[model samples]
Structures are given as structure tokens and as C-alpha cells.
Target: MTHTTLVTSIQESTGKTAITLALGLLAQDGDETVGYMKPKGTRLQSNVGKTLDEDPMLAREVLGTDAEMHQMEPVVYSPTFIEQAIRGREDPDELREIVAEQFEALAADTDHMFVEGGGSLTTGGIIELTDDEIAELIDARVVLVATYEQPGDVDDVLAAADRLGDRLDGVVFNLVGEGDHDELENDVVPFLEGRGVPVHGIVPRKQDLAGVTVGDLADELAAEVVTDVPTDEFVERFSVGAMGADEALRHFRRTRDAAVITGGDRSDIHTAALEAPGIKCLILTGGHRPPGAVVGKAADKGVPILLVRTDTLTTVDRAEEVVRSGRTRDAETVEAMRELLADHADVEGLLGH
Candidate 1:
């Protein structure tokens, strides 16, 4: 049987890694084994002789598989290395062939693998070995991820699609902004469709990427937790709704362990926080007052209810940055991340019985 491969590429700093992980999880839902490989990457530090994958640690957690980082990210051209190769000290084609060999070996073992390329599609034109050539070498299907924010972004993405030609399977327009999801549906999605690119998925700019706690974030960023809840038992997952008690309760229960962070004036969310069985803590973002009844219930249930005045989206964004950093590496956090990966990532789908 032919093992399929999915490729994700985007402009610089467009959160390609984030998109890859989320999609990898979605693909896993169909019970497909998803291996992750980065054929090219930004040069990251290695442990003496150990080469590591430049993707996020959470990636391995999601896939639940073990391979040498060097094998996973086989072709990383550092600045110094690039200079050397340019000066005829190193053969770029030979290096690429070696990397491709490792990639093919891994691809042969998996049912479907998600390979993420660094930056834009044709970034590494060094010695004229472009990303397109690399994709051709591996015989993988390409998926373009573009953030629908900058003017002419669609044009840029379409141009990329044109260059990729037959290797391109489809495109996924990622609306990576603080704007409404409806705007993407109304404005952006149609634009990509007109260009004949299939819209695989549209992910609204989530305030939080992986569910991580405020205390854990504070500890990581070394920022103070401007809330009442103890930092230890804080929850990270969230589904925000305009302050309605019924909606809040439903959102709270939809995910396993999460903190319901909302405005203090959102009495409905506060009430739901008090009642939610799965809630680890209640973060009242933007320093609003909780209803007396809601406060009383939270106290009685021994659930920590916190209050902060920062804007809701900003708070979540900061929290995600902190969590991704190697700040809170306790047993619980590690285990939680690992569990999430095994349950949701592409490797698990392909590997799990």
C-alpha cells in the first residue's frame, strides 16, 4: 500500500507548526497513523552529538512515537554551514540526498506522515535546491497554510500554488487574526475558493493553543498571577462565550479539564464556573466583580476563582506563549501534554489499535 504524506508550508512566522499539530490531530480522528517530519528547519541547538527536531515538544507528545531528532529533521542548513556549502566546502545536493534517504526510510514505515517545511515553499534556494525539489524528492502532497490578514496575502499564496503546480493537493486559508470567524467565512474563504484552492480548514485565531494554566504561565514568564486562585491547580483549556449562564455551563462541560476565564461582569459565566464539575479554577479576566451567589458557590465547592483585568484575548495569548516555553515541566503538566498528544495526534491515529 502507498503511504500518503501531507505537507504544510506558509510565509514567515505564520504559526505553521501550530496549524500542522491541529490538523494532525484532526486527521488522527479517522484512525490514521500520522508521523511528523521536518525535512528542513531553522538551525536549533543540539546536545553535543544529538540533533533535535526544531518543532515543538508537544509535537512528539501528540504523535507518541520515538525517532532520532536527526532522522525526523534530517536537513537543517545553518548559516555557517550554508557559507561553507557556498564555498564548495560542502555538497548541498549530496546533503539533501542523505536527508531524503532518512525521510524516505521513515515514510516507508508509517501509513501517513505530515511533513512540515520551514518558512515559505521555496525558501532554501541555496545551490538551487529549492523546497519544491525536496517535495518532489519525497513524492509528498502539499498543503499551503496562509494567514488572511496582510493585503495581497491571497495573491502571494496563489502565486505559491502556481509554482507548486501538480505537487499541491489543496490550500488551507488560516485566518490568523483577532477578527471574527464570520469575516473569514464571508470574505476570505470565498477568495481562496475563487482561486481554485480547496479550503481544508479555517481555524479562528484561538486565544490559547494547548490548554495551559495561568499559574503555569505566570511561573514560566515570571509574571505575577493577578488573581485569587492558587497557582498550583490552575486549568488551561477554555471555550469562551458572551456571559450567559447556560452557554457558560455548556462550554465548561464540553472539554475535560479547563479554567473558565471571563469578564467579572459575566455573571452567567461566573455562575457556570461555580457549577462546573470539570472546572479546575475560574479566571475572571479584566478584574470584574463576581456575583455574590457565584462567589459563595465557588468557595463552597473549593474551586479557585481568580480575577484579572487584562483583555480576554491578550490574557490567553500570553498564557500560550508561557506554556510553550520550558517553564513548567512538572510531572502533571508533562503527563497531561503527553496524554493529549497520544489521544489526538496523527501518529496515534496511524499507530493506535
Candidate 2:
């Protein structure tokens, strides 16, 4: 019999995909065949003239699964679908049937199957396909991934526990900071376990794991890459060069693998960014082309220069959004995730071993 684990998160950007993929990897390492599916697709993307969810595509690439994309993502929650459901034109029973059929087909030949939830546990509630509802539909165990930023964040986990009840096999805390680790272990974990909630893992926050490539930032902002340097470098964080050149130099020096955002005409800041250590890319705003000297310097230093039409503030906002929406595209990030889970998470407990 195939064991299905539904991995959902309390809120958005809580590392659900990362944890799900890591679990699948662990299962695969144990000589078990694994499959993955996302019942409701929210992160829409167009590929080869077909609209599909991004998560399943990433899973197929990572796991080398043989299932087609449509089988992996049975229903996509597009704008039209959401509108129909809200208008009572779409039948929830029919949607649930579709999801069940796909789930069965994928589980037929695998020892373990991972069903990733939408942005949150309550996602698709309008259509009666929330994470808990889907878990009941597929007879799967639930694993919630939560982000621990403060003491009060435990309330969300408790709430989820109340909702999921016995179906919740465990919870994994992802992206936890170093300073909060002690409190989580001593106080929060014990408190939750006392309430009959299982804390499976506590993953520390790593800058490389949360980073985005310079190319990803450029694509999100629709910026123009003016230089010929490679844009594939991973940017751990972004710095705004709004201050004086000297101050910006000091700030840039403090950051590693960072993208510096400044006005294109600010040649002083541009030059300083190139000279500073760990400056991976320069995002120039206001559509102003940097001076020839600045471009030449950036090119010589192997840093890509991106020109954006928006102001610095808007550009920074878009860049921040890109970084916040982390992707597990590269092998290094996947390896790091595996190591973190191996050291911190109880994979056997999560798998009911």
C-alpha cells in the first residue's frame, strides 16, 4: 500500500515545497519509489502552449517521475475556476472526484506519494477542497509546515492541530532563525507536544537557501540586462544604494552575494558597488543608462547590470517579492535542504516508521 502524505503550510512562503521535496528525497534514498502531486494549482505558468502549476513541474524535474503534468496537477484554481465556484456554477463533488482519480493513479506504482497543498491550509475552502478536506478525500496523513518568527506563531499551529485533529501526523518548523532555536526547543516544542502535537523538525534559516538568482530578479522586474555578464549568480539579499558613495561602499562590503539597487545615473554608487566585495549584480532604476565607464567597470568585474523603468522604491519592492518567493531550482539548494532535514527532522517519524 502506498502511503500518502499531505504537506501543507500555515501561511504563504513557509517552505512547504522545500519540506515536501526533502521528505520525498529521504524516501527515495531509502530505496522507495516516490511520486508527487499538487491537487490544486495556484502558481500558474505557461509552457508549450499549456497552462500548468509550477510545483509539479519542479517535482517532475527533481524526482524524475513518469507521470504526465496533467495527472500530477488535476485541477488548476485559475481566476475563472474561482469565479465559477464562488457563483455556485461549479460542483465541488465533481472537483473532488477529479482529484481523487488523479491521486489513485499516481499512487499505484510508488511506495510513497507526496501531495503538496496550496499557499495555506485554508486554501480552496470556497470549493470545499482545503488541505484537511483533501486529506480526508484521499485518506492521507497530514503534515503541516509552519514558520516560527515569534512566540505567538505557535497559536497558528495549535489552531491547525484543532482543525486537523488525528489526521495531523506532525508539524515541521522551517526557516527558523538562529537566535530563536533555543526557545523553540526548550519552550515551544515541549508546549506543543504536551498538547498532543508532534514537532517533527526545526530547520534553521540559511541565507543561501532563501536566495534567488540574479536572472530570477531580472525576470520578475522585467528589467533590461545591459551588461554581458552572466546573471545566474545566486543573490542572498538586496541592498539599496540610496546613500552616499562612501556609505554605500561600506554597506555593500557588509553584504555577501547581494544585488545592489540604485538609480542608473548614480555613477558614484555604481562605481562603489563594483569595487565593493560580494557585489553580484547592480539593479539600476529610473531607466537611466549608466555611464560607459560604470558599465565597463561592472563588465570587467563580471557583474551584470540590470536597467529598470520603475523608480528605485518600486524596483526594490519587486526585487524583495522575488526573493521572498523562494525557488528550489538548483541542485545546491536541494542538497542543503536534504542536509538540514537529515540533521534536524525525524524523517522516520514523519513517514510513520
Candidate 3:
């Protein structure tokens, strides 16, 4: 029998994908024949006239899994499919069987299979395909990834343990603030262990791991690149340049490797952003073109400027989503994640060694 592990999270944007990728890489390093699958894909991308899940495609690229794209991601949560399921036109048993068949096919050739779940444990509950349901279906162990924002976040892990029961292998706490590390290690971990929840890892918040590239932001906002500079630079944060020139500069100075979003007509803000330190990219909104001097200066500074037709608020919202949903595409970020996992996470325990 193949050893199967299902990696899910308490909620969205909790570095679930990063954790999954790191664990897969660690397993491969151990000379284990590893396979990957995402039973239900929430994010859709078009490739070769077929809509596929984005995460599984990334897995194929990074992990070099031999499975075809369709097999890697068996079901996509498209609008039509969701509507049909909600209207009682889709059969839950049939969908579950399809997922199980795909799982068995992939597990046939591998010693270990890493199954990635949706954004949360309850993501596919509407169609009867939640994380716990799939875990039971495939007889896979469950590892819950939860972001530790406050002391009460442990409640979410306890609830997940209750739902998963004996299948709950452990929990990984991600994006933990630096100051709270001692508290989590000293207090939270022991408390959870007492409650029958194993603490597998406590990964601190890393800016590089959480950052999205300028190209990713452009794709998310559908913006036009006005500058010829490279868009591969990582944007660790973002600042809104709606204030006066001096105020904007002061605000921009506080952040490093950030994207500045403001009205394109705000040449004053644009000039201030270019003058300020750590501005990686300029996102000009409202379709208004910037002055030639501002564009020339940005180009000279090697900062890419993105032009979008959306308003400042909308652009900011989309940019935030990109950062939260960012993938582990960069080599440095992946290496950093591997190191963090090695130091903090129990790789052997997670892989059932």
C-alpha cells in the first residue's frame, strides 16, 4: 500500500502551498518516489485550450511529477460545475469515485503520494468533497496548516482535530510573527500536544516567501507595462501614494521592495515615489498617463511601471490577493522554505518514517 498524506489548511492564504511544496521536496531528497495531486482545484488557468488548476501545474514543474496535467488535477471548481452541483444536477458519489480513481492511479507507481487540499478543510463541502471526506476516501493522513495571528488561533486547530479524529496526523503553524516565536514554542506547542494535537512545525513570517513578483501583480491586475524594466523583481509590500508628495515619500520610505499604487495623473506622487527609496514598481491606475519626466526617471531607476484601467482601490485589492495567493516559483524562496522546514518541521514524522 502507498503511504498517502493530505495537506490542508485552516483557512486561505496561510502558506499551505508553500508547506506542501517543501514537504514534497524533502521527501524527494530522501530518495522517496513521491507523487502529487490536488483533488479539487479552486484557482483556474488556461493552458493548451484546457482549463487546469494552477497549483498542480506548479507541482509538475517543481517536483517533476510524471503524471499528466488532467490526472494531477482531476476536478476544477468552475462556475458552471459549481452551479450544477448546487442545483442537484451533479452526483456526489460519482465525483468522489472519480477522485478516488485518479488517486489510485497515481499511487500505483509511487511509494508516497502528497495530496493537496483546497483553501480550507470545508472548501468542497458543498459537493461532499471536503478535506476530511477525501482523507477518509483515500485512507490518507491529514496535516493541517494554520496561520498563527493571535493566541486564539489554536481553537481552529482544535476544531480541525475534532473533525479529523484519528486521521489528524499533526498541525503546522505558519506565518508566525517573530516576537511570538517563544510564546508559540513554549506555550502553544505544549498546550496543543496536551489536547492531542501534535505541533509539527512553526514557520515564521518571511517577507521573501510571502512576496509576489511584479509580473504576477501585472497578470492579476491585467495591467500594461509602461517601463522596459524587468518585472521579475519581488514586491514584499505595497503603499498607496494618495497623499502629498512629502507625505507619500515618507510613507514609501518605510517599506522596501514595494509596489506604489496611485492615480496615473498624480505626477507629484509619481515623482515622490521615484525619489523615495525601496520602490520596486509603480502601479499607475485610472488609465491616466504619467508625465514624461516621471516615466524617464522611473526607467532610469530601473523600476517597472504598470498601467491599469482600474481605480486605485480596485487595484490595491487585486494586488493584495496576488501577494496572498503567491506561489513558490523563485529558487531563493524555495530554498528558504526548505531550510525553514528542515529546522522547524518534523519531516520524518510528516512522511510517516
Candidate 4:
């Protein structure tokens, strides 16, 4: 019998795809015939005219799975698909049949299948299918991914454990924010274990590892880049220059490769950031371009100025979304994740070897 694991997340940005790919890599390292599948999708990447599943590509590249994208993704919740499902126009049985057929094909000549889940436990509820249902359909154990970013996270994980019950294989804590290690290691892990939720791994927060790029901010915020800088430049920190130039400069200088969000009319703040080292870019909000002197300074300092038509509050929220949506296909990042999970998670235990 082939062993399979279904990776799911309670909240977004729990590094679920990275974890799934890491497990797939571990399986390959053990000389197992690994295949990948995800029955449903929400956060997607565009391909041609059809919506392609993003998670499988990571596993495909890592494991060299022969299953094509259509087979690996199985079903993608496109806009038309969502409309059809909501209007009761699509048959749930037909979808299930399609998933079953594709899964069997992918399972052929494979010793292990790695199935990834959508954002939350209730991801496929609209289509009358849940993560548990998909796991049951494919005979895969559930691995819930959680983050210690919020205290309510504990309640969320416990609730998921209660819901999945024995189907839950283990919990892996990923992307833990700063200063919460003590609580997660001392309080959260023990509490979950006491509640019978097997805690498997607790990955620490590394800002650089989770850093978003200048191009990501531009894409998410719809900002126009005023200077041509490396769009792939990773922003490890973000700061707002709403304070005095001296105070803002102190904070900005302390952050490595940080993006400063401020009004374009704030020449003082603009000048301060331009003078600071390690400042990746400036996000000028409210549709106002910085003064020519400030623009000249930015160009001179090799900093990109991103101008957005929206107000400061809107820009900040969008920036948070882009940063939280961080998932990198970089080779270094993949190797780092593989090493992290190998040390933290018991691949051998999960694989039943």
C-alpha cells in the first residue's frame, strides 16, 4: 500500500506549500516513488486561459513527478466554476468522479502520494467537499499547518483537531512571529499535546525567508514604479514614515532592506529614507509624486519610488497581503525548507518506514 499525507492549513501563510514540497522532497530522498495531488484550489496562478493549481508545480519540480498539471491539480475553482457551483449548475457527483479518476491515474506506479489542501479546513465546502472528505476519498492522513502569530491560533488548531479527530496526523507550526517562541514552545505545544493534538514541528520566524519583493508590492498595490530598480529585491521589513524625520530615520535605518510607505508629499520623510542605508524602496501613497529633488535623491541613492493612487491606509493593508502571500520557488529557499523540516518533522515516522 502506498502511504500518502494531506497537508492543510488553518490560516493563510502558514508556509503550507513549502511544507508540502519539503515533505515531497523528503520522500524522494528516501528513494520512494512520490506523486502529488490537490483536489481543490483557491489561491491560483494563471496559465494560458485555464486556471492552474499553484501547489503542484512546487512538488512537481521538487519530486520530478510525471503527472501533468491537469492530473495533479484535478480541480481548480475558477470564476466560472464557482458561479456554476453556487447556482447548483454543476453536479457534485461528476466532480467527485473526475477527482477519483485523476487520483487513481496519479497513484499508478507511485509508492507515495502527497496531497495539498486549500487555505483552510472548510476550503471545499462550496463544492460539498471538505479536506476530510478529500482525505477519505484518497486515503491520506491530514497534517494541519498552524502559525503562532495570534493567540486565537491555539483555539483554531484545537478546533480543527476536534473536528478532524483521528484523521489528524499531526500539527506543524510554521512562520512563528518574533518573541512568540517562548509561548509556542512552552505553552502552545504543551497545551495542544495535552488536548491530544500531536505537535510535530515548530518552525521559527525568519524575516528574510518570508520577505516579499519590490515587484510583489507593485503588483498587489497597483503602484507605478518611478525608478528602475531590481524588482526581485527582497524587503525584509516595512515601516511608515509618519513620524518626525529623525525618528523615522532611526527606525528606517535599523530595518534591513525595508520598504517605507509614506505620502508622496512628505519631502522630509522622503529625504530621510533616501539618506538611509539598506532602504530598498519608497511607497509614495495618495497619487502624489515626490518633489523633483526627492526623486533625484532616490535615483541617486538607487531606491525605487512606488506611487499608488490609493490612500495610506489602503496601501498599507495591500502591502500586508502581499507580504503574507509570500511563497518562493527559489532554489535556496527550497533547500532551506527541506533542511528545516528534516530536522523538525519526522519524515520517516510519517512515511511509516
Per-residue error (Å), model 1, residue 15: 3.1
**Candidate with better lDDT, 2 vs 3:** 2
Q: Write the per-residue lDDT of candidate 1 for residues 228-278, one digit (tens) a residue.
A: 545565454555646567766777776656666577678767777667687
Clashes (N, CA, C under 3 Å) per candidate: 10, 0, 0, 0
Model 3: per-residue lDDT, tens digit, 69-118? 76878878777788989999889999999999999999998988999998
Q: Which whole-number lDDT from 0 to 100 does residue 293 have in model 4?
A: 86
What lDDT is reached at residue 342 by model 2? 91
RMSD of each: 10.1, 4.0, 3.6, 4.1
In model 2, state the lDDT of residue 85: 90
lDDT, each prediction: 0.61, 0.89, 0.86, 0.81
Instruction: Between candidates 3 and 4, name the one with more favorable lDDT.
Output: 3
What's model 1's lDDT at 59? 60
The regions of model 1 sitting more than 4 angstroms off are 49-51, 56-58, 127-129, 178-180, 210-218, 221-353
Q: In terms of TM-score, which candidate is strongest?
A: 3
Per-model TM-score on C-alpha atoms: 0.59, 0.82, 0.83, 0.82
lDDT, candidate 3, at 17: 71
- Which candidate would rank higher by lDDT, 1 or 4? 4
Q: Positional deviation of 284 in candidate 1, in angstroms?
A: 24
Tens digits of per-residue lDDT, candidate 4, 264-323, equal: 899999999888897889999999988888878788777889999988888888787677
lDDT of 2 by residue, 92-134 (tens): 9999999999999999999999999988999999999999999
lDDT sort, best first:
2, 3, 4, 1
- Over 4 Å off, model 4: 213-233, 236-258, 268-280, 285-289, 292-327
